[model samples]
Target: MVRRIETDRLILRTVTVDDAEDIFKWASDPDVNKFMIYPLHKDIEVTKEWLRSRDIDGNDEFDLGFVLKETGELIGQGGIFYKEDLDAWAIGYNLRKEYWGQGLVPEAMKAIIDYVDKEKGIHAIVGEFAKDNSKSRRVMEKLGMTYWKDCQYSKFDGSATFDAYLYKREF
Candidate 1:
């Protein structure tokens, strides 16, 4: 089972079926989805279906939602994607527009990184962000991730693509 992690002001926990509405609220926002790998979800059913497809009980990596501990409000989602061949994991996260600039993402990410390094025996954690997203790049740097490569990443809209910076941090 996925474990719950607590920081001073946030809680990181597994996504649940009941979280469909909360997921839809932020994920459907075009601004939030602009730099994300996937397109903005069109409806609640789409969000529900996506959540249903996730495997929380298997060895597959998990995605978690970031919640405000005080109010139990969902603010963002992020987690590690296990890469067997690399013997590492890739980290990713997205926050609600209203929560931007609050330093919550970094806090949540740091906590998760600590968990992965200490409990999961991961050798390193990797991440890639659209080059245009300077905020995200800053978060990676804050987590002590160093720039390692550059490559093109396909956007949700098949009509175009953009450059991305790959980052990595070894344990």
Candidate 2:
């Protein structure tokens, strides 16, 4: 089962269909989508459909909703998944523009990384971000993840391509 994680100010729980609206808030924002692999969600149905397709059962991977503890609002999403091709567990996250520069992503990410290391005994965690996303890169750096390499990135729908910098933390 997917475990619910709690930080001092946030709750990281499995995504639900009910979270579509909040998800769309950021998923549709141009600033948030500027570096993401998926296009901006044009409708709530799109977010709902995407949530339905995610395998958040805890057996495979986790795509969690990051909720604010004080307001009980989902501020973002974060997850780690095993990549067969790279033979490593890859991590990612997205947050609403208003929450940017708050150090929330790193807090949530650190919780996930710790959980995975303890429960899964997996140490190879990788991350990648658009080269232009310095904020994201800073998160990786804060995690002490080392720069791996740069690779080509394509949107899920094949609508765009960009250079992506990869980082990895191996225990």
Q: Find the candidate with the highest TM-score and give its number.
A: 2
Highest lDDT: which candidate?
Answer: 2
Report lDDT (CA) for all predictions: 0.85, 0.88
lDDT at 149, model 2 = 94
Candidate 2 clashing pairs, residues 3+ apart or interchain: none
**Tens digit per residue, CA lDDT, model 1, 1-171:** 776898999999998889999989888999888888777799899889988988877554757799999899998999887887766798889899999988998899888877866766777888888899899999999989999899777766674577899898997
Per-residue lDDT of 75-110 in model 2, one digit per residue for the tens? 999988888788888999999999999999999998
TM accuracy, model 2: 0.96
